[model samples]
Target: MASHNGVNRLFGGTGGVVDGHVHLWDTAAMRISWFRDDLGLPPRVGPGDLARAVATSPVPVRAAVAVQAADTEGESRWLLRQSAAHVPLPGPVVLQYDARPTEPDAWAGMAQAVIDDGATAPGVAGVRLAVPGGAADLSDVAGLDALCEGLAATGRVLETLVRPEQLAAVAALAARHPTLDVVVCHLGLGTGEPDASWRDALAAVAARRRAHAKLSGLFTTSRDDAGRVAAAARAAVDLLGPERLLFGSDWPMSARVAPYAEIVGRTAAALPPLDDGAAAAVWSGTAERLYGAATRTSPAPRG
Candidate 1:
């Protein structure tokens, strides 16, 4: 479809815009992870296309976080490599990998491999897991819980992909590891029954304050229903406040839905306006707090 994203109207605020949710994929490297030909999404859109959108987008987009899809280890690993190789990208724009739970007996041992590789991966800020999706690694409970437990042990935030109703599973897991930070993706997602289960889940996260929510991907999940997404985004901001709200672009996944500019624009509008500090927090500081990404080293005070 032609990119008729509603960016300009929603464009507000002069400070930098940080998109909190997007995904990336390269079809040539491997099959598009989330979309099988059978599931029938638009032709696979990749990073090149997203870069184009970011460059030409009407909104004042300064930075964005690109996440990983459930499938395609190549895409996930490639994103990590790109994060390390690119000199100017200035991120903690990360690759959140999918992880499987281990067999009951072997889980304790296997956790180290996944956690070690992810933590040591060149640009892996953290591992990303979405329930009911991703590889065989995450497709089952025994497997997913195992991975969650391990990531929790390592203190990597649990990047959870959840629909509102299904979020209880993550909540249960979060309950187990009070210390683990859970960054919930897509506002608990949405489908035929999008509702307060998201509110409830956010409450669950808030209670522990061991969680964060990426205020992104509304365009993909809601798919042009800008009003509803805007409303949901506001509620999330109201509940989580600017401090706990992080941005993501949900990129390659957003292709068939809308551009990053529109996603960011709509999400920005939905939330209450921020003062300078809160604005800084949502734009980047908050992510810095959550991800441990290094800030710029100032030039030495030289002669």
Candidate 2:
């Protein structure tokens, strides 16, 4: 939000934008080994940096769910601490942790312990299970059902970072734990996937009452192809409807592809015909519902 020239025009003074996906990282504070200095990103990006990033946006970033950048409890704890003390109205955090296939019991124990501790962390809104740089196969993940159940019991969400091929597994997980809220991230970031597979899998997940999709990372996935981005947005809207879709700016990562304003503007322009109520749900309401209503300010933005 650092004074991007067309940002104001893009969001048109609409406030109450609840970004559903946000990542904060620092090499020293937490292990961001995946990040490279050559990538042009700063060594660290914390709450203050995030605030400055969105300060000049056309829409007011009323709240955001800070996602885990590293797969460690240290990262989760750091985010929770930041949430408690950040200058901006800190929102819930979607934790990122490593659940390797080889150490099922160890991962389960660690995850269970974290979930136990999360019950007391007010900002503990959700958990993320990401399969780094590859398609996710939850078939071998340990205590997956129990973890999902634990999150459900505590009113926390399970956010999955999976490719389109893996959505069937997500749908199955949702079916098994009907009470759990599962949010699929990055618009099913799969490359060279069949249209039928992506559409069918999304529809399958959408069939679940508690399963939702994030309209994020599209600019990165689509490589800023206006036609492809719009088509993907239209497909999601058509399949899941507005109530189940949430908006997000992947932020500094997406800066490689397009500005924050363009990502939001392009996504909005891509959606199918929607009433004001539906649009509001996509912008912030759904995220509020998923993360937790108490953490977000529900003021409706002006048209």
Candidate 3:
């Protein structure tokens, strides 16, 4: 229930506008828990306080998939509990648990728990992983094959965050496990020749047709690095096409990188020009179909 000059607008209708890969982290747990104690991955993310970050805007995030930041199932559980509490204005919830090949057996069991809770609850949708060579080298071991087999057996979608350099290997993984619906996060790193390698990666993923790419984390590619990543985004939409494009804020991660709205809004605005309906697909429409949130229709009110 939203209003514009006293009438509902932003949160109305059948349009399932969503940032496909937005992350939700709260101060409920020590931020260090998000990273590894031994690996020292984050300086100190500290218990992330995210609600205020999402407060101002009417971004009714119908469904979001948080990636496994290379840890155990503990973080995933906390996120689920957080999702269960919010109501009405907050919107229904769901999450994607992170999986790593290092602990295949443990990751498998964690996947089951996530599905058992998420799939049945209506908000939880799939499991997330870092594709070989994208984050960690895929050529390192037979881990990907094992992860795929497990996901195929369970009928879960696999979300992957890959660097442009890792596209070929990712393609092979997708081909190897055709049964799994793969979500490629980050528009395959940024676009442009300076990083054309990543763009080629996006092209490779799009060629598979089974692959889906998320327009998330531009802040990682730009702000902290270069400048606006719209050029990179436009390059991806050009190669991958808006049909396969999905929007995401990358949330808490963006807290230090970019405001949630800034990342999502700028990416949406910078998307390669799409004919009316096509733009909606990248911004929210297609996410509804693949993530399965479309079935639960909600009203969309204009801001």
Best candidate, TM-score-wise? 2
True lDDT of residue 188, candidate 1:
75
Please report the candidate that would top lDDT against the real structure. Answer: 2
| Worst-scoring 10-residue span by lDDT in model 1 | 294-303
**Clash list (residue pairs), candidate 2:** 1-53
What tens digits encode model 2's per-residue C-alpha lDDT throughout 1-303?
223434333343445688898888878887775788788777787888778777755667888888877777776677777877874445777876455445444332334445445343556777787863554557666557766765676677888888887888899999999998889897775323337778888888989988888888776445446667667777788878888989888776776776666666666666665666787788888998888753322221111
For model 1, how does the per-residue alpha-carbon lDDT over 119-234 read when each residue is reduced to its tens digit?
Answer: 43424445666564423223354445555555555445567776675566666667777776778787676432246766776676666566677766666444447667666767
Candidate 3 lDDT over 153-253, as tens digits, reads 54455676666667677787888777766777776573323266666666777777767788777655344333346677767677777777787766656
- TM-score of each prediction: 0.73, 0.84, 0.71
Model 1 stretches with alpha carbons more than 4 Å out: 1-15, 37-48, 58-63, 72-74, 88-90, 93-122, 133-140, 143-146, 153-155, 191-194, 220-224, 294-303
On lDDT, the stronger of 2 and 3 is 2
The lDDT of model 3 is: 0.54
lDDT of candidate 1? Answer: 0.56
Q: Rank the candidates by lDDT, best first.
A: 2, 1, 3
